[model samples]
Target: MRDPDLDELRAELEEFAQPEKKASRSPREERIIAGFEEIQRFVDEHGRAPRHGEDRDIFERLYAVRLDRIRKLEDCRTLLAPLDRQGLLSGAGTTADAGSDDMDEDELAAELGTINGFEITELRHVRPSAEKRAAEEIASRQRCEDFSKFKPLFQKVQEELDAGVRETRPFELKAEIRPGAWFIVGGQKAYVADMGEVFTNDQGRSDARLRVIFDNGTESNMLMRSLQRALNKDEAGRRITEPVAGPLFSDQHGDEDQASGTIYVLRSKSDLPLVAENRDLVHKIGVTNMSVEQRIAGARLQPTFLMADVEVVATYKLFNINRSRLEKLIHRIFDPARLDIEIRDRFGNPVVPREWFLVPLSAIDEAIRKIRDGTIAGYVYDPQSAQLVRRGTE
Candidate 1:
């Protein structure tokens, strides 16, 4: 009963309504795009491209290497050029930071892996020979001869966990490997006691030896990759959070009981000749649970601000940390650079401000980096070198 003309019209309209086919990319191109996007995310969050340095976190160093390689390759530049809204690719060479080469381009690509939401292009049915050897090293654990020294640490971690001062969360990245970091693997609490110098493996990948102490008093000198693999394979693998004071910083926040605060670095805007002369070098480091704006209000009326207006140089938001202790710890690290200026309050009482230090902003950035990775305990800021040096080395 239908008209032939009506049927023909409906068929034509259906053809017009079909969706356009997306441009398909080759696996190699997809991998390149995925890797570049990771760098882009890093830039977005950190406000700068990752730089290379021993003081820099391992992941930042990896990103620095990755960015350098991407710049060198014409194909990567071409593929990522359209997506470089931040102009991250326009810079020449990698950041000039102090560190040796860890991984070449191909290995770095593999390390970045296929980013989430992308179809994974690479997979292996069998573990690599190097990874297999690392697994063996982990399996051949020895009784820690100096277990007594580490016993108190394990107990303290447990106490903190019970007291809700520290909590454990899922472990996701190999970059988390560092001294003083704790993890739960294979039904045991594992701690990274120390890490050795970064070295290139025979496979041309960046790696380091880790001294991992188990709560059971067994210890293993395993390659960093081994611990990563173990954690990835275990269903219950978790990274134990750090104590609130000697805090290990985590990005995750919980609703019930996570303490959050900000670490603010301030530069005095006083017109005083000495402060004006060294304005760029002097900074006040403080941590507060309230907003920085609220805390800095009435700066000109407060001796703590040198009785002058101030400029916020930087602020780092932290979670589940003791702001007071963190403030004190940072103060202690830069104590040698403490500014010796005396400012009078509205009551005409002279008071020497304790928080201000005559240190460059870059040095403060490096100190925060060490603190986030839980390595600040072993480092002290040397004003002569304007660098964070090992305790015994300086």
Candidate 2:
């Protein structure tokens, strides 16, 4: 048997469903009533309140329909009401209505609130495509996993930096300011720095300054050019510099061949201790499990330290670690080895012919922190299970 509330709601809907007998009701009012009946039918089928979940697509469509009805009803109200008092009827209309001016302000406000509440509720039902796109953009901006907490950490780092605390180590090296001798700093996907045109004065002395050139032809010269200037003062008057740029060698040959000599040149510089220090920090942060000593001892090891040439090396290393963790999660969730897995690119374009799953770095970091704090359930998928079973769900 249907519930008493459902029966009553059905009866109310039936009353509005019939043709209006009075002249007060118009075609717009009829359409509004029809829309209300549709909403009632949807509620009856769901047997619960509309909400955001896997079925968001349905929720949003219904919400938009409901809003359209409200708008039509508002339009009908405006047409029937007197010009001076029309605002009192629709609540949002701007008609001055001197007759309704004498009405209680509190009652008018309450009526306005009702309309606004309905409007806001409908707006919450955002389409999945738009929601997904917004989520991805937010994720990209926050490149790290723990974005929520990272803001404070980043602020603290910046504060320390402003107070002359060198959290980043700078590498010291002597390179003759010559043409085609560019040093790439940061990492494999390092943000490129511009090498400005070498300017020569009449005195025959070339002002050896490095300038960052953008695609727009604008330029920004390196502020602190010399290692002596960067390391002149340290904590308690001791000189300590952090490496922001790695070394690179370039010849007439392609960039790949140039990288070999660049690596060799960086490795031979034993006097500069920044590379070793950064390698140690990378291991300590758990981004890399291998120590510098172990890496040096390996059979595949070469004479050069390639770590010096990349720009923002430490940040990029962190980015890679985050990507690896996300890949593992995707593999576990879909179990590609067992099922027909399909992956797609950012634009929903087919990529790798396997199921693609993405978790924003910020979201992943926040999830990890929550798990540690015992605020949320933390689970990693097992490839053998081929199901989305929680870590302690047994």
* Top candidate (TM-score): 1
Q: Tell me, what's the RMSD of every candidate?
A: 22.8, 26.3
Q: Report the lDDT of model 1 for residue 270.
A: 93
Assess candidate 1 and give its TM-score to the true structure. Answer: 0.42
Per-residue C-alpha lDDT of model 2 across residues 286-390, encoded as one tens digit per residue: 122333334334322222222122122111111101223323332343343322223344455543322222222333344333322323223443335433335
Displacement of residue 281 (Cα, Å) in model 1 is: 0.7
Cα deviation of 362, candidate 2, in Å: 36
The parts of candidate 2 lying over 4 Å away from their true place are 1-21, 49-55, 68-394
TM-score list, all predictions: 0.42, 0.19
Query: Under the 3 Å rule for N, CA and C atoms, how many clashes does model 1 have?
Result: 1
How many pairs collide in each candidate, listed in order?
1, 26
- What would the per-residue lDDT of candidate 1 be over residues 1-394, giving only the tens digit for each residue? 9999999999999988969899999877887787778777888788788886423454565677777777888988898899988787888423555655444534433443423322124533333653454233324577899999999788767745653345788998888889989999878999999999999887788899899999989888888987887788879999987655343344455565455788899999898888999989989999888999999999999999999999998988777665666677788789999999997899999999999999999999888877665556667888899888988888
Candidate 2's TM-score reads: 0.19
Candidate 1, residue 109: Cα displacement in angstroms equals 62
